[model samples]
Target: MPESVGMILTLIMNIALFSTANYLAVKLSTRNVKRRIIAGVVFLLFTPVIFFSTLYLGFTWDDTGWGAGIMTVIYTGLYLLNGLILLLSAIHIYFKK
Candidate 1:
């Protein structure tokens, strides 16, 4: 398989795994702690996706290097979304409010 194809496959798999994991975490979280679980999962997923987005897409923001040269925006966005979900979960868990 081509390198690009492999990268795509890897990205798909990452999405699948993260989604499944998040679902499980949310399902397992206590009723009162559901939000925390979600936030945690989103945060967990976000870290890798954000990191890879920077690497694979090679984003750059002028001199700051924020966003640029992104090769896979769709997949990267999915990752970012996953991260957001995890963040919400974490917030719920930590604050417990």
Candidate 2:
């Protein structure tokens, strides 16, 4: 397999893994239809945001990629989203009982 192909595969895998995890976690954590929709929508929106904004290093092709941190904010955004979902889940559990 070509290095570029491998790199692309890895990138897609990253997006899929994170999005899928978040989708399931938030979807099952709450019964509210609105919250479920929001969780799905956020994953959809986040996919593109992380995809376009992150720089693909040459490591994709076994070469050195530009060590740019331009898309670092996406990481922060993901962390924030994660915390938001966890908090929302806790709130849902609290009010449900």
Candidate 3:
């Protein structure tokens, strides 16, 4: 497969993952503290998963293409952003009256 195609696919997958995380966070925001905490923990755990998966993808690709490398970095960064958002939401829920 071409590097551009791989990059596009990676971007699409990143968008899907990011949107799903945000959707779940929004849905969980109204739930009880326990569920929010659990969701936050799950999100936190996902950060390392994302890191490892990106590493695997980077290594698995046959070509050392700049496009793929950039996309991988973007993917990892977005996952970290999602994790932060979820963690903050959980913190807010915990402090709410």
Candidate 4:
């Protein structure tokens, strides 16, 4: 529960999520350059939308107990997913072949 421990755990989790997303994106796109480009663009647009929506929900929600715990998980998952997507998409765009 220490701040340093929490930061380290968060860093590890983000790296894991980003790695998974990168793998999936490569597998899904395979040798299709066009597919990868399109997916990158689409996810580029979607990432910020998801990020802002998550922030909005976090600020508006007032639930406690199980509800709050569940929401936390959901929000974290969403934030991680979108963030990884954004990063992977940018990589793809920059390294386009």
Model 3 sits at a Cα RMSD from the real structure of 2.5
Give per-residue lDDT, candidate 1, residue 16.
Answer: 74
Candidate 3, superposed: residue stretches over 4 Å from native: 58-62
Runs in model 1 deviating more than 4 A are 34-97
Please write out the lDDT profile of model 1 over residues 1-97, one tens digit for every residue: 4545655565566567657766765666655455555556656556565566545533222232333324345545655666566556567566764
Q: How close is candidate 2 to the true structure, as a TM-score?
A: 0.44
Where's the lowest-lDDT run of ten residues in candidate 2? 67-76
**Considering only N, C-alpha and C atoms within 3 Å, which residue pairs clash in candidate 4?**
none
For every model shown, what is its TM-score relative to the native structure?
Answer: 0.45, 0.44, 0.72, 0.45
Per-candidate Cα lDDT values, in order, are 0.55, 0.57, 0.68, 0.54
Better of 2 and 3 by TM-score: 3
lDDT of 2 by residue, 3-97 (tens): 66765665566568676777686657566655555654565556555554454542444454542232334543674577565656666665776
Q: Give the TM-score of candidate 3.
A: 0.72
lDDT of 4 by residue, 11-83 (tens): 4554575457656766787666566665556555655554454444433443333433454455456555654
How does residue 3 of candidate 1 score in lDDT?
48
Candidate with more favorable, higher lDDT: 1 or 3? 3
Best-performing candidate as measured by TM-score: 3
RMSD in order of candidates: 7.0, 8.1, 2.5, 8.5
* lDDT rank order: 3, 2, 1, 4
Q: Write the per-residue lDDT of candidate 3 for residues 1-97, one digit (tens) a residue.
A: 8655655566676678778886886686665776666666777778777766665665555366555557667777776676676677778767876
